[model samples]
Target: MRIETLGINHSAQEFLAEQNITKLYPPQADAVKAGLLEGQNILVAAPTASGKTLIAMLAMMEFLSTKQGKIVYLTPLRALASEKFSEFKKMEKLDFGRRIKAAISTGDFDSVDKESENADIVVLTNEKMDSLIRHGAEWVDKIGLVIADEVHLIGDKDRGPTLEVVLTKLKELPAKPQIVGLSATITNSNELAEWLGCKLVSSDWRPVPLAEGVFDGGTILWNNGDSDEIESSIRGPPIDLCLDTIKKGGQSLVFAETRTRSASLAAKGSDAVFKFLSDSEKKYLEEISQKILDNNEHTDLIKTLSSLLKKGVGFHHAGLNQNCREIVETEFRNGKIKLLASTPTLAAGVNLPARRVIISSIVRYDVKAGANKPISILEYKQLCGRAGRPQYDKFGEAIIVGNANSSDLTEYYINGTPEPIESQLADDKALRIHILSHIVSNPGIKGEEILGFFQKTLAGLQIRKNTLSFSIEIAKKFLLRENLIVQKAERFAATEFGKKVSMLYIDPITAIYFKRGLEAVSENNAHTFGFLHLVSSCEEFFPKFSLRNKDYETLSTLIENKSSELIEPISEYDCNRSLLALHSWISESSEIHLSDNLGIESGDMHRMVETADWLVYCLYELAKLAERADLLEELSTLRKRISYGIKQELVELVQIRGIGRVRARKLYDHGIRTVSDLQQIPVNKLAEIDKIGPTIADNIKSQLKKVR
Candidate 1:
């Protein structure tokens, strides 16, 4: 079906046709024909850059026209949300007289206040939408349709719960608006479709036919039932099978196991490719160099990238920072640079399509163990899906670069499919808090009355026995015995306390813990006790910080230096566990001894750190909800000392803006520890403490006389 035939009009069709998108890809054509134009929910499974985005936009536009509400295109990443914002702008311009005002809600805290209110068709990350709905934004009622891009990410433990809740909340909406789920053909499309109440349009067909192949001994072996293998090695070297595909007028993407290796490969390939570019091309490279130096920070890696750009090549990874990654991706896509070596993060829904995709190492570094280990099959498929952009190239290539065991490569890459999508419902903290919020916010009577609600959740799926009894047990803890839940005339109802807990949107247990941490931190003895709490938090519950380059010996020395000041003595075991967690958080994995015969793994450290970081963020927010602002500020300061960045400075600025404890403390620390201390600081030095100019210093000095 043409874009015009679906009640979308010729102008929209012609806009696409003018860009040479005359015919839709199978997934796009199928979605449009499957009554998506009639406001039906759609689940489209197609490869990346295969015009699935266009399919979503068409559906969004149809919903906007037929309904009196806004359309939300939600993505998993801020970067992806930004990308969709740009794509939607083009559609907005081509919408004839029906102007759709679109905006992105990703950057800046102020974006939440401004864009979300008036957007006719807004694009936002899933987290932002999750927060919005939970807070009961007035604009939630204005939303008529939600397009969940990369719906497969619902399996992510950290983010999956939010998506699941958002979907569940949407189902509870009065209108029951249409839902569009888009993905790259995961293993269980039917199950996902059934869950969302949508039609599954699963197709292996691409507008551009993709020919699968394996390069064995410098020969390209096509999987098109050809008994004969084609001979070629022009791509570079058949050392990695993808090199053969590169020689055949196709670009290949090699997924490195580590950020360090990605940069190393890019660096190695740069010198080889410099000879290919002309003098003018080299000058175009210099232009990029100047642009990088102008816009981004002057880091050693940035400087190194500037030099590499001169040779018409570059690498990408998270370590390079956002600005550098964006530059590398933009340049690579424009064909200014060829062959990007990147980590699996680059595979997370970035629209960089390559003719051939190579898995240089399926095994990524295990930060806990301090070594490399094999990745899950789900990750492998996500990376390989980057190949085969529909309507552009005839065939896409995916190859695994491995050891002498060539047969093993085929099994891992070809035979492997995406793993089962698991629910994060088993998460204790997430479940307790969200459920409490639901009970509190809505007018509910009894604990047993809402047991059915728990059963609707993924967590409820795992209730092997006595579901009601288990829920009532958990609900009692959150609602409290005398708090708000009451058995009235055989029905349960939320008391005033239960209502407050729902609005707080925190687990009752965590809320109690937050209070404990706050109370412990706010006392006169807090200065010493705070550090102990922070350390213990890091060790057991909070995301652990890894200080790379600090060995066991080095940490032991540091701990010794602070031993007298610390509330409790630091031990070797504590030092090792803390260090391991920290390294994993920063993606710097190393091995450590656990027992005589067994050692703790590397990557596990980082995973633990990630878990800690997320929990900390949650707790900090919970503290604020509990009205423990002072404790929250104190903990935030500690968190900042561990993770340094400009954002931390901005946070400090906000914290100490006016008549606040932080401002008073800074004054006190500067011999202006109190209101009186503000009278004593040498005005010149005050200018150095960000946002406090000389004039403000003079004003502060004048206000000092009012001190009690």
Candidate 2:
């Protein structure tokens, strides 16, 4: 079917043709026929890469052609938001004659971009949009359409509540924007469509066909009862499958359960990958491998990844830095890398697809359960959906390694339906945070209104109304006890501190934790490790460093020595280790050094620092609220020190934009210690310092001038 037949604008059709996307896939056609172009609400639940994005683009263009209001495209991940932002920004280049401004916002939850407020279309992560709504951005009232990508993540435990509450709140807005939810096929999509008040278009149609099967020994028993014999050239099942796929002229994707396993499998499969690579390919991969190494800190993981990339294999996980992940993804998309092993993070929304996907393990470690649990059928389907890329392969192959439980695997995964997405909004922590946000956003909200708001949620629809009401009451009671909220008669209002807490995007519990820590701190009690422990103990800065046996011994000794100054007696090893890690970081330890000494990945350290910095800022904000002048000065210093990973003396010097820890140390060593010294130093002399280029020197001078 032609894209023009879907009632898209002439310019949009021309743009599609320019990109060689003149024809609509079956799912796109179905969506169009379901009134997607007429500004009607739609739930498009289809396979991955089945023109779902094009469907969204068509709807956006239709809305833009007739409406004056803005369109908000919400994605689940920051990476996906960025990718979609690039795709949507191209619409501005089309000959549509109108200035369709596009903007993207991510990471920062406290502020909304002014450009996005005035944009014709804005792409943002769901959390960013939720934050905007909480802060009561004026432009949200002008929104006429909202496109929620990966709407099925409404079942995710950590992020689902945010997306669900955001959707429910958007629908309840007075503007009543039309919503277009794109999702992978889920079992209860009909119920979801009913909840969203949208017409459903659920289809299994794909741009490229997918063949799913179970591999046991050397044979693949396909879903259709057909069998294929592929002997293993390698010992491991994952490597053998990868080798077989590469021999068939197809790139492979291996999905392991854990980050460790992903790297291990990739390393084990590197030799087999080398056998398949040509000399030219090997040379090109070596260059790419060197680029990866150059872009990252020289850690053991990076060394392993760099070596494996030379053989056309690489491991990808959240542990890798953003630059390394991007390099691997880009190279794989360009067909430079043959096999990539990754955790399920790659299966979520990233557009890196492969010709064949091998599921090395069906089970994942559940931290809360403290055991390995089988992944849901929905997760399995998501991994399988990455098998084929459109316009690249005739068909995709998704093979699950079978074992003694092969029959059950074939029944439950190969032929099974995806599980229904359930609402996780009823979680206590999620409810507490969002409840504060809702009240702070609208201060006059009464208890009844709060109940009504939650009643409109998916969780309210799934569970009993009284159950949700009880949970809301519990959150309200907790907030009142914490003094974050004050109740008068039937109306609930956020206290001044509570309003700031919501605005700062920190959890109410985290705010309470900071308040307690601040109350415990005095001139004699205040210590660096004490404050670090308080920040690490908060729920917002969780999944802290896991304590090894040696770490427990070290932290135990430290805790015994500092028990009087510590916020709480160190009972949890994880919390103590987190403090130790932060201490090392602020003590000017390099990321590579931290990874080697503390067993913390560079990426994890970066995450910890980012979270700790925000929490310290929160502590400073609380100190000011409490009018603790002495504590304020101390926390302000701590915030800067943690933010830059610098010493007390270098804090002021690192305040300049171009001067980080290393540059600050260099400037101090060169007798250019303070801003006054920086003002007296020549730009050329400053540039001559180690790691400081002329551009940075100029930037430092420019920044100093502005400060003066």
Candidate 3:
């Protein structure tokens, strides 16, 4: 179907032409015929590399043609939100005959982000949209179109409930915004579309079809009944298939179960990949390899990744910092990296297609189950969707290396259909957080109205009514017991504490826990380590640390020595690992030292520091609410220390511009501990300090003068 035949506005047609997109894919044509341009809600469940993004853009362009109201785009991950934001920003160049604006909000969950209210389009993560509603973003009523990318996450355990509740809330908005849900192929599309009042346009079609098969040591048993001989290598099965792809002038994306395996296998495959790289390609990769190591914080992961990049392979995971990950992604996209070894997190992210896909393992570590299990068919589909490069390949190959489980892998993952997506909102922990949020946002909301709101949720529709009712009751009891909500005259309202907790986007339980810790810290005049220990207790923000067998004795003795300073005073061995690791961090320990002593790398340490900064701010806000302002001064300093990973003395020095943890440490070692010290010290002497040159010394002098 042609864009012109869809009867979209002239500007949308011209926009499509500029991108050389005249004809629509069959799935996109189905969407157009289903009234996508006429403002009907739609759920597009198609394979990856289909025209889903184009379908979404057409809907948005049609709505923007009227200039009646703004568009809201929601994604599940920050990476996707950024990708969509960058993609939508190009709409400004369209011949809309008027200016178009797009903005993104992903973090800092407390503020209202008034800057984005005027944007014609706002791209956000699911949690950010929920946060905006809680804080009452003024543009809620102005939203005319809401596009949810990765809509299948409504079935995710950690994230599904939030997406479910947010979608329900948006459906009830005054504007009646048209909702466009973009998803991977799932079995429950009809059910989900029914819940959303959407036209379900679901298909398994793709621009580049997949050839899925199982690769034993001897041959690949293709689904089409054709077998291809594979020469096994000591380099491993994944690298073997990857080399096969490279020989065909294509790239390969390999999914491993863990970060360690991702790196290890990438290294195992690097030599084979290196052998295939032309000299020019090797030279192009050498520059990227240097860039990977250039001006970045040295971590064990980065060093290993940089070494692999030079050999035409890369490893990707959450443990690598943003710069390294972006470098890996860009190189792979540019076709410089021949093989990418990654975890499943990348499967659900922005499109990064290769000529072939390989699954090194069909089993993964289920953290909750405490064991390894077979991968779901839906997961296999998601990963296999990355097999082919659209417009570049006629067909993509997805191979699973099955030695003993070859028949089971072929039957279960290749032939089996995806399980229906179910609700995780029936859990008590999920309900309590959102229940307080709904009540706080709509205070004095009656019990029936509140449960009625829950009734509108997907959980309310799919799960048993009686079970959901019981869960809601338990949630309400928890809120009341935790003093997050108060009841009067058959109505419910959030307490000031509850309001703060909800607006800060924290679990009510964490707020209650922090409240007790704040009171104890204020009462006892506890030191800085106490607050670090307290925030470290919340595993949602600061991740849990794994304790080594040798450390139990050391931590036990330290607990004995610092018992008066530790706020919680729970001497359990498992509880203090995060505190101990983070303590080693803020003490100005080197990355290698932290990795050796605490088993935390630079990327993980930095992530913890960033989360600690926010958690510290939360503690500061709650302290004001608790009237424990006495702890405010110390916490203010502690927040800065957490951010820069510095000690108390360098906290003052780090406040100066152009000085980070390293510079401030050098100054502190050189007897310049504060801005006043910089003012009093000679610029020449300050320049003599290690790593601080004359230019920085002069800049510090001028900054002090400005302060004066």
lDDT of 1: 0.62
lDDT of 2: 0.87
lDDT of 1 by residue, 107-204 (tens): 32212466668778789887677667756788887778988988878778767877777776775688888888898778888877877788998877
TM-score of 1: 0.76
Clashes of 2: 0
Q: Mind sharing the TM-score for model 2?
A: 0.96
Candidate 3 per-residue lDDT over residues 1-708, each given as its tens digit:
987888777877887898899999989999988999888999999999898999889999989886589899999988888998888998877666678888999989989786688789999999999999999988888888999888888889998989998999999998899999999899999999999999999988889989999998668999988999877788877888888888889999999998889898899988878988989989989998888778575667777888899999998887777878888899999999989999988998867899999998988998789899988888899999999999788999999989877788899999999888998888877899999999999999998888898989888889888888888888998899888999998899999999999998988888888888876774646567677777887745666665678778877877787777777666656455677777777788887777767777666777888788889899999999988867888889888878888888888888788999999988888777778888998889888889888999999898888888
Off by over 4 Å in 1: 14-20, 94-99, 107-112, 214-220, 225-249, 293-300, 365-373, 389-392, 443-445, 457-513, 522-708
lDDT by residue (tens digit), candidate 2, 1-708: 787666667887888888998777888888888988888899999999888998889888888877789899999998899899989999897656677899998876778778898798999899899989988899999999999999999999998999999999888888899999999999999989999989999999987899999888788889988998887664588778888888888899999998999999998888877998889999999998899778777989889899999999998998887888889999999898999999998999579899999999898888889999999999999999999877689999999998867778999998998899999999999999889999998788899999888888888889898889999999999999989999999899999989889988887878887888787776655567788888887788954756777787777777787777675555645464678788888888887887888888777777788888888887877888888887777778888888888878999898788788888998899998789999998999989989898999999899888988
* lDDT of candidates 1 onward, in order: 0.62, 0.87, 0.86
Which candidate do you rate higher for TM-score, 1 or 3?
3
Q: Report the poorest 10 consecutive residues by lDDT, candidate 3.
A: 568-577
Model 1 Cα displacement at 123 (Å)? 1.7
